[model samples]
Target: MALPDMDTSVGHSFGLEVDGIQIKQISEVSGLKMEQDVIELKQNTADGKYVIKKLPGRPKAGEVTFTRGLTSDNSFEKWIKDCHFGKMSDARKGGAVIVYDFEGNPIKRYKLTNAWAKSLEISTLKAGDTSVLTEKLVVTYEQMEAE
Candidate 1:
């Protein structure tokens, strides 16, 4: 039997059912290394602002990505957990998890009473400013077994 194509990278624009309405959501894995990994997501919107970016760098050793309210019973959050847990069977197994919020969503805001909130914010502005905010998700996966 042939092995499943280990997808090292993936990107997609999907709609997640939230509040009984389909909300646009994007997810992506930007960089990867022997040390750690990085993942990103954007949820809820029709405009381009609701998009995720594959950053150009990877995290160092001993790091984890996380999101707020994701532990709750939310569809979007569940999807993300699925991706990281096992659904994303291609991703590096046993790696760090990190979460980010661009517009400060109620769920995963970079704020805490005792925790230090920090993020590497990327400036979306450009010369043409014609870059349409498109929903996209990218991921780097590992080897897969054939069914």
Candidate 2:
């Protein structure tokens, strides 16, 4: 057996799901970052030579942004409000960003914990401009795991 082509996967084949909330449609999702900090230390030798060593620090959690066309659906907005005014014990939620194949089978999943909506914004409206109304949501999570 040989190694597979990782690039065979496409970026557009993905979706986001949150616990206890039904996600109808989302056109774009971005800022799913999984990263860590690097720590450097210098050790001084007796001969006046110093050696620099690098170590891994803590994991960093990033805010993910989702954009979708505005509709009658208000679940996302409600969730955002719940997180903003709800008690700390009942606000956080769990969610996942799942990547699927062309056949609709799941290929990868990024599980999130203690996730909550950080912000929500709606596109500016014009008098009679022929444009689609869109809403954007930013979500923050305490931790994430990829599988």
Give TM-scores for every candidate, taking all chains together and pairing residue i with residue i. Answer: 0.20, 0.88
- Kindly give the stretch of ten consecutive residues in candidate 2 with the minimal lDDT sum: 1-10
lDDT score of residue 88 within candidate 1: 47
Off by over 4 Å in 1: 1-24, 31-117, 133-147
Looking at candidate 1, the ten consecutive residues that score lowest on lDDT are 108-117
Clash count, candidate 1: 9
Maximum-lDDT candidate: 2
TM-score of candidate 1 against the unseen true structure: 0.20
Per-residue lDDT tens digits of candidate 1, residues 1-147? 222356222223212222234333323333323343556665646664576755445534322222222123354334445555656432233222223223222221111111111222223656878644332223232321111
